[model samples]
Target chain A: AQTVTQSQPEMSVQEAETVTLSCTYDTSENNYYLFWYKQPPSRQMILVIRQEAYKQQNATENRFSVNFQKAAKSFSLKISDSQLGDTAMYFCAFMKRGGAQKLVFGQGTRLTINP
Target chain B: SQTIHQWPATLVQPVGSPLSLECTVEGTSNPNLYWYRQAAGRGLQLLFYSVGIGQISSEVPQNLSASRPQDRQFILSSKKLLLSDSGFYLCAWGVGGGEQYFGPGTRLTVT
Candidate 1:
């Protein structure tokens, strides 16, 4: 069974600053996928970014980037130029390529971007 | 463009009452549908998933059941709702074994 762990329960950063949310997982599968989702007060789950295990280059989408260390099973999300609108609960997820391909989610990190 | 639709943005039902939530996907075919439940301030919990019509696999055994009657329509039902069933429900779909796309969740309150 694959399990995702988000070490930081809560994180805070000032507007225009940068912050990172740490996440780790346990999995034996060699091929899989990683994702980060954001849920604001509106409660809609929005995809921030995704990473394929076979790829060496980390995925970056503008202000959001991920550090995917396959050997250590660590995938952390870094947010740049944080804004008040960026305050939300971020969830780290893992998906295996075969079998259930179920997305295992972490506890989530509540990020607060202060003005 | 693909879009997923979930009905009844909010629902309130008494304990022991039945539950029926509907989800439909458009602009896609033979999609993988999923039902997920999120408790207050919690991560997503997968309840059921369907690869095709009438192929539902449950992740957790509970009072809830899911049915995929058509290619793009999935339904979640409960014969008798439990208080713990109170939470936000999200419906999702994926294509070509690719990334999952979520719908605006429905909040169910079992009072």
Candidate 2:
């Protein structure tokens, strides 16, 4: 069994500042994928970024990036130049290489960007 | 472009009532489909997933059940709903080892 953990229940950041949401997972599989998803007030899950276990280099998508430490099983999401629109419930997810592509998600962190 | 849809946007039902939530995908074939539930202020819990038509796999042992009647359509159902079943139901589709695209989600309330 695999599990994802988001230690922070809630987070706040001033507009134009930077914020980092921490995430960690437990999995025995050597090959897997990590993802960050954002859900706004609309309750729609949006993909933020992704990192493959084999890739030593972290993944970056514009203002959203991930710090993936495979050995420690840590995958943290960093938001640069945060904006009001970035306020949402952020979830960290894990997916194994094969099978149905089922995702294991964290509890989620409610992020608020203050203007 | 691929798209996923779940309905009816929101639903309210009393305890012991039957449930049927529909989900469909467009612009994709043989893609993996999934059903997830999010309780109030909680993380998304994967309920079921399918790799192809008529091949369904359940992740959790719960009162809920899922079926894939068509290649692009997945349905979640329960003969009798429980108050614990109240939550936001999400449908998603994805390819092998790729990111899953989520639907708008359906808020289910069981009183």
lDDT, candidate 1, B5-83, per-residue tens = 9998999999999999999999999889999999888899999999899999999989999999899999999999999
lDDT per residue as tens, model 2, A81-113: 999999999999999988777899999999999
For B14-110, candidate 2 gives per-residue lDDT tens digits of 9999999999999989989999999999999999999988899998999999999999999999999999999999999999757899999999999
The C-alpha stretches of model 1 lying farther than 4 A from their native spots are none
Interface RMSD of each: 1.2, 0.7
Model 1 scores a TM of 0.98
Model 2 interface RMSD, one decimal: 0.7
Pairs in steric clash, model 2: none
> Which window of ten consecutive residues has the lowest lDDT sum in model 1 chain A?
A96-105
Q: What DockQ does each listed candidate score?
A: 0.65, 0.89
Q: Give Cα-based local distance difference scores for all models.
A: 0.93, 0.94
